[model samples]
Target: MKYLLVQEDEEGVERLWGRCAGVEGLFVDPVPPPRETLTLRGCSPEGPLSEILAEPGVSFRGLGDMCVEVWDEEEPVQWWTLVDAVVVAHQPHPGDPARYDVVIGAGVRNEESFFDVPATPRFELLAGTTVAAARAGRCSSVDGLFAPRADPDPVPLELIGCEATEPLLVGTQRPRRWAGAWADLLVLDRHGAVMASCSVDLAVSEARPSVLGYGLEDITLTDGGTDRPSPAARGIWTEWYQGPPAAPNGWAPYDAQGRTAWLELTTRAWRGRASGPDRTGGAYHLDGRFVTDVPGLHCAIAEALLGPGRYFGREWNAFKDCLSGGFGVAPPFTLTWHESDVARDALADVVEDPEGQLSYFEETVQLLERCGVTVVLR
Candidate 1:
């Protein structure tokens, strides 16, 4: 039987096949690593078939009556018992030219494991030791420290206090039994202009840890709708500092259900020196605002922004742009509005659709209303 030996490291293959003392017609081919290249060749089979089958990283499949074994270093072996059946009897599907009916079946089964798995949220450090280390000299540079690395343990910044607005659903869907969450982290100066912001989506289960890192600077979290707690609101601000003046703006319209779905915004501020010689000291800020209209969605946003267990540096460029152009523009608007349909589907489906395939704008709006959040244009 003809066999295909797909392997990554040549040494791994040598270690597996080296033990085979008597095997005829055995052949070996080199395959590149998946991250880099795909290099492998056909090898003749000569040793004990069961021993080969039991090989640590080798798997066998049958092509009709012929047996094909796949070997790899990083991946476990996948055996095919009916290789000939696939090669000769399988017909290609009309819609998918590269995939045959049997191949499609196998592929489908292979993908079952990933069907409900959530994509890892992209993480970004708004500020922290990582950033401080990187920007020790450059003025234009902004640095951030992240988790799940060999870096030294992070110093926990004092939570001093936090200001949070009532939760709001930014999407247009009703509350389903299950839902995903998301949030943004914004660093702002006392004037309320954003210095840096990181947005993240949380996982389905809260068991996962999600946190956004920022430089040691004075910062505060605020809702996207700008419905921040008034400094005079007693519990919202401390006596050491006076809060910003209340906005003269009126509240947005409530949703169909009479629930005012104001965007849930949270801000956390701190004091720290900016990076550079002169070490010109300034208050560093970090803000987390929920841009999406999906309700109960802050958790997902938080995970996407801070819980990836790895540092995804500068992944917030678009977020920064939106903040700058939408909310950071003159007078420093409290909130910026955009169509929530696309954003809604991205979170519910967990797969970002560039064409807005899963958008259910009206449905999401109703969902927000059910969550006691009112949808209003800024």
Candidate 2:
């Protein structure tokens, strides 16, 4: 619950800025993707399609590229995408029992047409959305935009119950203009270990040297913004930040979103720590028991290479970057993936790729080999 605000210089010396008894809005929730309402008109879906729509709160994805292909009488029209599409309501067409009007809410459309098409198009549902699938206890991968809030607002962190040293409050007796200082806020757990951290611009609202608490005028994240964390997510974070040292696979208990949040926090906490010489040709072992999903695999990999609560990468591209060098280890290293069949089975779902659709496990193994990391599957 306590935080140490420190600034490290070029020489790696940490300068104490202040200390806070509490912090607010630190662990943010993943921003739900943008949503739009569309009416699927005059479509007579049969078999499982009707059953899927008849069910409530069931989300699904489209076919190739996970996009809904809009087709006319001759050829394909527009390929629309609904990241997480769920049926809101449906009704039979006024005159035809064979046709139905279904209104659904889904993530924003991928491609937008300038003008309306003259012909009516049909929608085909193919797969499951990452959000829905993950929530449904299915293994899913985190997309590029899945980590942060969609079209996020500016991140304003509030440091409550703060106290500063006299040297930090000398000129703040009067109402003078104060520009915020950029520093890293390290949240320490009960055992005085870093649980979470972030680089923030700290603007002092009131510098009370002796007071037990004073407010922070402004504290915003320097790196873009994020969606506000939900109450449930905040509760999950409280457990981690207030508990003892994070154990390996500690993030496995939570759902996909919660696991992703843990990875984000771990990623921030491990920033700047994965430095120094590359341990090239080192053989690291990745325990695959917890590698049920993409996010879980990332967490497991971090701990496998580094220690507990460490971070190597979040998604595939970042992993590729890490493989290049400077992330604890270099390429040409042998990674013996223990229990590799766990991931191979769990991540069997095919995902969208630049070349085409590929299973998550296949893509990951291919990426590791392509990046010069000798992947020894066990």
Candidate 3:
């Protein structure tokens, strides 16, 4: 099936954002139809299994995986749970060549965000998920699209029509900033092509507003506590998440404690001679080169790909150069930032000057693309 995410206005000039492929590696409880029984049935009392077996509805969950079995189906059925699961898809049925049949799935899990406040949280997928797919592209690993996690069953799904020229309404979402709230606008083409991507942020630096060009050396982030402006004049947050640095459970809150400074800003990019977004124009190629999740792997990837050229440690230019294929053996190569970054945006700016790193990344990514190398970091 093919899918696309787009942002269109009355002007009819649309933007292409990203694609979704059904390969997010998650097992979800598939909600059965209204009249159909989605839960497991025919339970008998065993000493310890009695309570579990007696429940009218059954959905089992675990640390990472979840599962459910239904023997009463037209055919026996099994389901697992997905996080931020695929909600809808356009599936092409066998013998049907001209039109696409939408393949939809039920959201089997019912877990609320530990925090009820909307859009402040993030998620992790065992395997990264693409919310939309390209034309004629295979939807791998994950099969059917799902409803929202909060809803156990599917709701009315409004999607763009299946025409490449039709503009669709992709969502307006926020990218995780190092601290506080910020968001970006993403626009995509009907066939899952990226048109234009942009964001709006506080743009503060050295007590001066980057966007408005005003200075606020005195104002700070204080929550009933005294403000302590620092090196760059931004105050350390007090009562950031309604409490101390850590939650009552003793775990560090995601937005607190300067943790975002250390977050790896991952990106997916290709740097090669003559390689197109379609992956054409070269015999020499390297693909799916994952920089493993291990201590110092960043340095390791830099050392391997850039040789003696510095990718990290020292300064920002070194990091940009290494990623842009300055030190790569390079004919053409596509590089991805692995899986974890998907849980949170890899581009939570940490540099006191937010765009210091942002602009360089943008510049380098565009330079690489113009040079026939494609880099993707969403």
User: Number of the top candidate by lDDT?
Assistant: 2
List the candidate numbers ranked by TM-score, top first. Answer: 2, 3, 1
Angstrom error at residue 325, model 2 = 0.9
Each prediction's total of clashing residue pairs, residues at least 3 apart in sequence or on different chains, is 95, 3, 27
**Tens-digit per-residue lDDT, 38-147, candidate 1:** 11111111223223323454332321222222223232133222111211123334555442222201110010121221232111111111101010010111111111
**Distance from true location, Cα of 166 in model 3, Å:** 33
For model 3, give the 10-residue run with minimal summed lDDT.
Answer: 216-225
- Computed on alpha carbons, the lDDT of every model, listed in order, comes to 0.22, 0.60, 0.27
Could you tell which candidate, 2 or 3, scores higher by TM-score?
2
Stretches of candidate 1 off by over 4 Å are: 1-148, 153-241, 248-364, 372-378
**Over 4 Å off in model 2, which ranges?**
4-18, 24-35, 39-84, 88-103, 107-158, 164-186, 190-194, 198-247, 272-274, 350-355
TM-score of each: 0.17, 0.59, 0.21
- Flag the better candidate by TM-score, 1 or 3: 3
Model 1: residue 280 alpha-carbon error in angstroms: 48
Model 3 segments more than 4 A misplaced? 1-81, 84-145, 148-198, 201-299, 307-327, 331-378
TM-score of predicted structure 3: 0.21
lDDT of 1: 0.22
